[model samples]
Target: MSVTASQVHGAVQTLTQSSDTLFLLLGAIMVFLMHAGFAFLEVGTVRHKNQVNALVKILADFGISALAYFFIGYWVAYGANFFADAQTLSQGNGYELVKFFFLLTFAAAIPAIVSGGIAERARFYPILVATFFTVGLVYPVFEGMIWNGNFGLQAWFESQFGYGFHDFAGSVVVHGVGGWIALVAVLFLGMRKGRIRAGKHTNFAPSNIPFLALGAWILCVGWFGFNVMSAQTLNGISGLVAMNSLMAMVGGIVAALIAGKNDPGFIHNGPLAGLVAICAGSDLMHPIGSLITGAVAGALFVYLFTYLQNKTKIDDVLGVWPLHGVCGAWGGIAAGIFGQTALGGLGGVSFVVQLLGTLVGIGIAVGGALVVYGIINKVSGLRLSEEDEFNGADLAIHKISATSDD
Candidate 1:
């Protein structure tokens, strides 16, 4: 016999709430593990001397992001300002608190991505300073204004397109910030000493493959949370988001293999690039769209990494631009191409809107990151001395070395 209508309703509610809570919690844990990935990946990408420094920076920056988010970052980025007329902060639990927690993790992760680009050659103290500025001040303000509907891009996204913009998982917000920061750091730090000196190529090999591979894998796993949890509610949509994520990873891997690199480092960029590519439209895309996005991102990442490393002379040690920035741009545009209002209303999965939103986000993130880092560079100095860099940041700044003593 069929259940009564009331009974059916009750069962549905219970199932949805329980599943939502479980998935969100699981996603949070997965996202947290991404920090480990960053630690291993960044450390492995740098020289042996800077291994400890790379790990330390990742850990410390996370700490700083947590603190900053708790204090001001949360309020600025995801506070109850946008839907001011529509909602209010109750006693304890509300969207305000929920959004804060969700966005804080993302804001923190952005700076972590940049840590690798400046590895081996940036001062320890400067790392702390940069993290503070990036997480505490820069990222929060930009993200809050745009997506949170508090101050910046909300009206633009809404008025110009007749539909608000949607990131699904912060392609423009988190990755864009990190990419821009990496750009600034590299420009300020300049090329590694021998990389440019006397025109001799001093290949910087990863110190530990385990660390690098582990980091890359962890990042891929954690990305499920990074993309899915952004929904703030889990339903069938969670499955779609997760599916897109997987497809994108496959695409990235294929692209990496096609790029044909002797080094694993080049190949590793594929997964990251794919993740970044699908971020904007994960919830909106068909399975095929996700697959294509990931594939393109993976291939683009390898090519971009090679070009930046050999041709452009910008030493993005962790390949932030290709993985986050370039793929982020792709994600944004893909959102425009694939996004549809039928998929997720008001958010207007429209491709045109997505393209405009992507450009806007890029312009602001790139320009703002450049300015903030430039100012920091002018003040305390962003790069370690040539001697310090050659010796290793861990030894120069932290007084510890990964290498064994004789």
Candidate 2:
């Protein structure tokens, strides 16, 4: 029997959709691994007693994020839902399902980012509650505005600035939002016990530098997926994003090394700062521009992290506000600068538009965080008791230490 042209065309179309779905699935899986990176990073940074809590919070936040996003967040952002039957959902090789999974990884990252800031003393259930509302409501609203174009926000920007906002991969959408929200939570929670003695900052050295290094390495590796897979489809994928990511990572590492004066923690985090800054413009900027962006972001992390810890005595435990909040914002705005033709970039981004988009994200994040964390603080309270705090979250929360001999 001869296959007709229609049959052949249908086969090819199915094959293409299947390939795209697989591509997205792999991307989702890779991003899911970044949660591990987040976990390890926190584990390495927090005191030994709090290490288990750090590990648990990352995993728990991801689980909570998955549920919230699946049931509420996705629909809130995109006006879509999983109320459809599996047969209907599986259409297009289940691309939509895989897309949800991919984006869920990003949504979950918000709580993970916060985990670092509030670690050591936050009540676990309260943080989970915050995660539920955050992923379910706050994050999705802005996410929809930027990615799904739910509101006329992007259109409004274009009307005024000659271009819509240009966050190609959520420097502002994910990292910046997560960072700013983390800041509010950190402020509300206040410094960890013993974090400040007198008016000066007290040093609580990282529990494990090797573990910290490992976490940084994992994040660095997984970020490629975080950046590259952001294209969402095979046809949209670009080598440029990957190259830019690499250059930016390298630039951050080098800059942090110099600015941090060979501090190991700073050295590891340098690459992350660079990657964060380059995400918004990776597709459009020259590699050199990405390198500069990354370098600046890396230096920013070193300076801000130090200043906050020593000068202000704001105990952002892992400096999420600096690493994610500020660097992420810088990256979003930098996209506008580096993505212009005059600066060896592709020239569709408007600086003013990018600036406004970033500000909006930050504003929403601050408001949401204050509301969520504030209410949670007022209602159930957000901190462990002083006894629990002194005992370490391992025994207080998890009933065991990470390295328990028994």
Error of 2 at 168 (Å): 1.3
What lDDT tens digits, residue by residue, belong to model 1 across residues 1-406? 9889999998887777666656555666677788898899987778788888888888888888888777767766655333344345422224344545566678878778888787777877766777877787777776776676766466776777676667778777778667876787778787877676567445667778878888898898888888878776664456888888898888888878778464687677687888988887888887677888888888887887778887877888888877888788888787776565454322355567777777777776667677777787788888888888888788888888887798
TM-score list, all predictions = 0.87, 0.98
**Each model's lDDT:** 0.76, 0.92
Clashing pairs in 2: none
Off by over 4 Å in 2: none
Report clash pairs, candidate 1: 37-215, 145-152, 251-295, 336-351, 339-349, 340-349
Clashes of each: 6, 0
**How many residue pairs clash in model 2?**
0
RMSD of each: 4.6, 1.0
| Residue 399 in model 1: lDDT | 88
